[model samples]
Target: MQRIAVLTSGGDSPGMNAAIRAVVRKAIYHGLEVIGIKRGYSGFIEADMWPMDLSSVGDIIHRGGTILRTARSEEFKTSEGRKKAYLNVQRFGIQGLVVVGGDGSFRGAEIFNSEYNLPVIGVPGTIDNDITGTEYTIGFETATNTVLDAINKIRDTATSHERTFILEVMGRESGCIALMAGLAGGAESILIPELRYSIDEVCEKLIRGYKRGKLHSIIIVAEGAGRGLDIGKQISEKTGLETKVTILGHLQRGGSPTAFDRNLASRMGSKAVEALMEGYRKHMVGIVADKIVISPLDAAFKGKRTIDLEIYNLANILSI
Candidate 1:
């Protein structure tokens, strides 16, 4: 491929800038021209793109979010919109494409490629970490760390008041963040959508911890599982314990990416460029067992990334 374009779509996630930087610099290093598409497929449809160079991505490795920006394009769902995007692709003489985002973004790229015959590679970049092909998405570690830090601070207050704190973390269809943060933060209870949870059982666990002379209890709830405020009210009514709810909305989506995230983004980003260079189309670069693996982009959306039941059980077992 002589020239390629890259874009980030869907929700903004930490470490996306790192991924973008990697894609730009790696492409330039390989003597290939790079184009930055602003606002994802919307930009592609509108032809809102510009050439990128090494300096174009300077000092963005530690930054959060994408320099190229992202958006959900309702217009892009239409055949007319894809036709417009294809026109731009032809206009720019773009030979390959790199897409960084979650499942929805991958699905769009997959469709766009099939219709236009453009070589496309995907790099997973969602905080939800729900993409099936990857073991961990770009921003998952940073978001989990963000939640863990909040839990640590909340623990101090919960202990001081001897109260139950219900922390709601972002995870609409997945519980990776809540489960990981809850387990690492030593939460007394974790409620996730993937696993059916009973408020009564949650209350029982809290009451048992209190009877055992525990000064405080931390309960982590994925938003998909339940609303923190409702869960808190129910726990207070059932257990007669003072409860506080902290909804960490959007907070988990912003931050300087953690080292693990930066490294993962860099590796995945470079792999995406390499994939295109190797003439792989409609594929995604993912990490498994700390090694980079490429899979068909369809694989990312065809299945679901299930929560680790072993980790869930371990968290429950250790909470006691």
Candidate 2:
């Protein structure tokens, strides 16, 4: 029987558990012994592992975060650490490994596969949605939904107080989450890392809204777009308008997987299994145009995928 190991790394996001559950079930159904690695690259070096079965993954599809948990370990970067990890894999008799994480995880997978000849499969699990090979990652949809919920609530408070609230969502380098959530939440202005805006322009917009007798305004800013608090201060100083700022932190990564995420995870997980069975190794399972596909792990690690400019422009047009 084939032995496989799986782990999640980097920042946690919604639907990670669902992906893990799918990996376990799909691998086991294919007559492979599945092992769950605790923590992340650290667990691999420390040899922290546990047996995973259907029962162990029961009811996790609806959960958030990860059942096996996650962390960042610099050990994976060191040659010694890589060697130790290779020894551990052999010790456990693991043949194929699955990693669910963002770009950092993909980098580690590429190095591990290149140096040790270990076949590693990557599943995009970051809220940033910055991984190039995948059109949409597992946690991105749920994170968008979570931000929308918060944006709605903030809108209510802003309207009541007649205040202009600047809401900040997390998406370190990639603006995918901010773009989608801002568009869906009907934000008046969206600031994304991919697009830079003039502070004077934003103030002018606020001034225009005030002239139009708009009581409240919602401006969504990506964390990496700039600085939410700084922007709010600037707006308050420029427009002499009362402003409130809300930063949605890990809250975006802690909700139950949405219907879309559950379905996507199941499909991606199953496809990953099929790819392995077909003798395709060292790849990432990604969804492009609603179809399951595999891309080279190295390619995913090399390219920088940011928010699509056309989509961002369309969002601006539609918002107008």
Candidate 3:
């Protein structure tokens, strides 16, 4: 490929900077010009782009979020908006494009390619880890680590006061974050949307733990399960325990990426560049079984990525 452009779209994810760096450097190494599209398809349509060099990404690997920035474009969902973006692509002579984000971003890439016959590649960069065909997305490790850190600090207070704490973590649909963080943080009860949850049963567990000489209790509630305020009220009313709720909202979305995330982003980013150079398009790079694989771009959204119920069950058994 003579030239390619990259953009980060949808929600900003940690480790996105690392991925951007890899894409820029990898493209430059292959003697291809790299362009950064600011604000995703919004910028793509507006022609807000500039050429990038190796030094453009030199110091971004350790940073969180995206250097190119990100924004959800309602206009881009329309055909007219995409046509404008296609015109800009031709205007700049960009032969290929790389998109980093969730399935929504991939869907956009798929549509753009279908309309204009442009080459596009997708790199999964969501913290939700809900994209199909990939075991883990770019920002999941950092987000899970962020949640674990919050719960660790909450545990200290829960123990000091011998009170029950209900921690609500971000996971609007997928419970991967809740399940992973709850299991690792030694939570007493974890309520996720995927599995059936019983508030009465949750309270019973707390009461039973109390009877068994466990004074401190931590119940992790995924946002998808119920609002933390409501769940805390239900549990407190049932067990008569002084319960408090702590919602780790946007905090989970920001942080310096962990080593796993950095490495994964680096690998995915480099692969995206290589894929374009190797005549691949309308596909996404996925890491399955520790090996990088390519799949149709729409594969990320064709089905839902489910959590391992066995892990949830094991977490319950160990917590009890």
Q: Give the top-scoring candidate (lDDT).
A: 1
How many backbone clashes does every candidate have?
A: 0, 0, 0
Report model 2's TM-score to 2 decimal places: 0.97
- Cα lDDT of model 2 by residue, 1-320, tens digit: 38889999999878888888888899888888898999999999999999899999998889888989899998889999999999999999988888999889989988899998888888888888888888888889999999999999998999899999998889888788888988888888899888778889878887887788888889999898888899999999999999999998889988898998888888887777677777777999999999988999876768888667787787777655
Error of 2 at 316 (Å): 2.5
Clashing pairs in 2: none
Could you arrange the candidates by TM-score from highest to lowest? 1, 3, 2
Q: Show the colliding residue pairs in model 1.
A: none
Residues 139-258 of candidate 3: C-alpha lDDT, one tens digit per residue = 999999999998889889988999999999887788989999999999999999988988988999999999989879998888998899999998888889999999999888898999
Residue 22 displacement in candidate 1 (angstroms): 0.9
Looking at model 3, which ten-residue stretch has the lowest summed lDDT?
Answer: 168-177
Residue runs of model 2 more than 4 Å from their true location after superposition: none
After aligning candidate 1 to the native by TM-score, how far in Å is the CA of 93 from where it should be?
0.9
> For model 2, what is the C-alpha lDDT against the true structure?
0.87
* Model 3 lDDT on a 0 to 1 scale: 0.92
Task: List TM-score per model, in order.
Answer: 0.99, 0.97, 0.98
